[model samples]
Target: MEHSSVHHPEMPHIPSTLTLASRTPTVGSARKSETRHILVIYVGGTLGMKPNSENSLAPVAGYLTTEMRRMRELNPPSDDFAQQGSSSSSNSFSSAALSNEMRVPTFDVIEYAQLLDSSDMDQQDWLVIARDIERYYYLYDGFLIAHGTDTMHYTATALSFLLHNLAKPVILTGAMVPLMEPYNDARRNLVVGMMFAASTEICEVCIFCNDVLLRGNRSVKVRHTLSAFSSPNYPALSVMEAQPFRPRRHLLARPPTGPLAIHSDMSGRVMTVLCHPDFDAESVKTMIQGTSKEAESRLDCVVLELMGVGNTTSTMARTLQSVVNTASRVGCLVAITTQDLYGSLTAASVSRLKKSCPDAIFVGDMTTEAAAVKAMYLFGKKLTAAEVKEWMPRNIRGEVTTVASRL
Candidate 1:
């Protein structure tokens, strides 16, 4: 990785040795003798992209490590001020100046490869990321993933399910603009994400963008602007932008009760169906068939993005019902998620589905991405349909704020 002085220049130098060995991909000196180390996993995102001579954004050959260094420099710790403030007994002026220095937490960079548009992300990519989380789950106090905005929600949801019983923060963040722009949003979002992951006591995976911290599975890309992710039905786990970066704390989910279990055996046989205005039975059949055919043998689950209140017209409903039946008969688990960004399925939809597919599990109010990953997670657990049917609706790490009584 090449070094640059463009991001932050006011701080002390980071040892190149650490930069080379650590995945954080930073340019900061070794740790401050006492602060605990925070490892940053740069998996590629808008944060490492910059405009080329042609004026289109492209991945800078070595932006990940450079940005990590800049993030540390821009937010150097406050220990110096503590010494300064205490050294002067009655000198209120010096003490005040010292107090003014921000308490910047130091983070180590672990630069991983895969830094690209989040859209390029797929099942293999997700498995690679999950394996990284497992490989480093014990080494670092927390993890920060810089991803592209396009499919951050899916990754977040996937990680939420893949990483079960997490005891530390796993914050996913990205920007509307590339890191190299003069006034790029990546700097603040990335910096704040590091801070959130380091300080939060929450054990669940989360998505942090703009000033909001959303539950990983609940989050969705609601816009193209810098403030792209949101979970309207659920309150933010925390918010950034406050001085000293105090997370709402209250919104953060409770810490896990057990040790982290990184679920590497996730079943990639999951599929998704969107409930569009023009409902077609053939389309539903084709989608399920295509996914199963493409899998050649792996397909084990499917998720339907039902319309408002989880509704599907009788025609489309029958189609989905048939698809669910087919998938179920083949030992595939079929699940339902509402198209509405914030609500759970209605009793009507649940009842209709129950009569048609009797044994299919519903994802309650969770987002589509969450439903997909959760389905994979359950399938991989090798739980019997009866077992998954019972556990899938429960609030596991706050994935779903509510559960349906009907199905």
Candidate 2:
């Protein structure tokens, strides 16, 4: 059955938002779990950076490699670097080799070319990251992406779509502070992210921070200072505490059969418009035209950030029409999403999108980040326009959900 967001007449469209009260830690429970081989793909972020002798920050890839190797050496029987799909007997022997006194799980590190800052990340960066995941997909039981929080959600959501039929966990994690800092949050989060990735209970893309694990597609960075990322319209899969981290497995997507397929052919011909208080024809025209020029081929999709309930001032009506005209003429799709994070916009708020651009798709309640990446991934795939239209609203990997508005 097709699922659309539940409608509220009074609040035609609103963005998703949240203010969560911290939950009390789960008490007095004993649960046992297995240790799986995990791959740590370190792309330079705060977690993988440190201040140098000159007081300049540089990628701490060397530090990560040395520390991890030293840890593995201390525990000679460490099975962290062993390849995946090796026989169970082999894994058992490796696990035993590392299991001298303390039975700690082994992990491997593969540091790619590091990004100076996440802000410099672009389409080419995404491709490299996706290919890295592909290269290690068969070699590791699960994977972790240590990315900058600036665009972690985007990477997570993009990879969720790019890596299809994924049966193992792909967890993205980073910290608010650098690992060199005295009390940096990276240590706990990275360790926990790896643990969660290794868990058989989680079979989807996720972002782990502040000890809480959220569904990748549903997560967004909410606070700059705090380690926690929020899933405004959805609940987290699990929250890791002092002792035991309990995962709500029923909330995650079921794994698909067959080997993992990484789609590196993202069109990168999409645009995202940020909404403001005063929007008009001239401004809208400028944004739409500017983005069109930057596309790889013809523009594929344009995601508009609209005001409350997805509505725009009447002055911008022609702007919307112009987007519809230009996009439709060049075989592009234009969509409208709310600037707000707590509520979804109505298709009626973007009525011109539905009528003028018949093939255009509207993203209801999805973050601008997820919507843009999804459009790029789906644009030139074998999927038809109608299929794109339909799939946009469906929860392929729990990216979007059908929930009633409380507005």
Candidate 3:
């Protein structure tokens, strides 16, 4: 089923909104319970970027699948290739890889009609991917997303929230280098991610890169290197060396018993402000008070990116409480998170912020990427301001660590 998003006039291909076909009921199809048929959703990124006319790296249509099909390890030539009669050229080609290896599962690719640079993705793109999984939920055993590294963390976090009670692995992967280039990391990332996606033991959104598996919401792109992501506050759920066992201990204990739930209401708007010496409450007041009549433009939450100790400047402290009171009245949420990558907010700082902004949420140890998407998820689900605070500290998706500290 082909689906197209609402396109922008200037950027015709990149849609401002996406629409997916209605979900179909799971008719007792011929999907073998024991078989691993992974569905790979390829949303373009650096993994498939090729040099174009200006000699600048850009995503080319049909470039990814063309390059990927040549990987013998993924689509290995089988001796039984003669079994498929005349249709062997296309039919046998797909089946041959099915018997490739136990670790190498058969997969079908659904390339987006308009390949998006990861930077071009929006909340609607996340919703489209979630609905895609729902539409084909009954057909495939697992889902793997090929995304750009730039905003992979955001999409991964959004998916973690949008797709609830997931019963299969949803692994997102992309390389710093494009697959068309020699000596690139795309193959290793893709192959390993495929294996994980095919595994029945893992049942949550995760990012597999640089030989390690990090929880989707817990991950962040640390640098512009092959080692793209890191789970700073938590240990990796699985590593290449400890796979098939490490996940057993560190990952979600077991797949959820309930049927998978998909939440498409990620319409929440949020803003991030770094607390500097110039940080002031007046600007934040304007934001929470509703800057525009456009519902989509208005913010539902504001993430206060605080210092290492989670405290802001005295400049902003002057009218912080009053602004917070306005936020509470207008149904806006105030979230506090530390700037440190590895360290979480302290109890003393959290208490102080909580005292000042009674309705403020102390996002403990959550990466800014995770925090931002989480706010969008919460508001998009139509949660009340009180509910946002209620859910903020709780570990709904393994994104935050509940730290107990003294003032």
Top candidate by lDDT: 3
Query: Which stretch of 10 consecutive residues in model 2 shows the poorest summed lDDT?
Result: 17-26
The best candidate in terms of TM-score:
3
- Give each model's whole-structure lDDT: 0.65, 0.64, 0.73
Model 3 lDDT tens row, 1-407: 23455432322343322322111112233433444667777888888789999999887766776666667766645432233233345643444333222255657666777778888898988888887787667767788899999999999999888888788889999999888788999888988888888877778899999888889999989899999899898789877663232464545634565787775488788888787656777777887887676655667888877764325544444456666687777777778777788887667776767666667777888988888888888878777767777787777778887632110
How close is every model to the real structure, measured as TM-score? 0.79, 0.75, 0.82
Task: Give the Å shift of residue 137 in candidate 2.
Answer: 2.2
> Which run of 10 residues does model 1 get worst, by summed lDDT?
16-25
Model 3: how far residue 166 lies from native, Å: 0.4
lDDT string for model 1 (1-407, tens) is 22222223423343221222332223354443333346676666778787779987866645767656555443433444234335544433223332221223456565543355678877666666666667556656677887888888888887877776777788898888777778978887877687667663657788888888888888888899987988967888766543544556677666655676665467546777776867665765555555544444646667777774334456666666777777666566677787777677667868877776676777677777777777667767776666666767777757777632211
Instruction: Give the residue spans of candidate 2 off by over 4 A.
Output: 1-34, 70-104, 283-297, 309-313, 316-318, 346-360, 380-387, 402-407
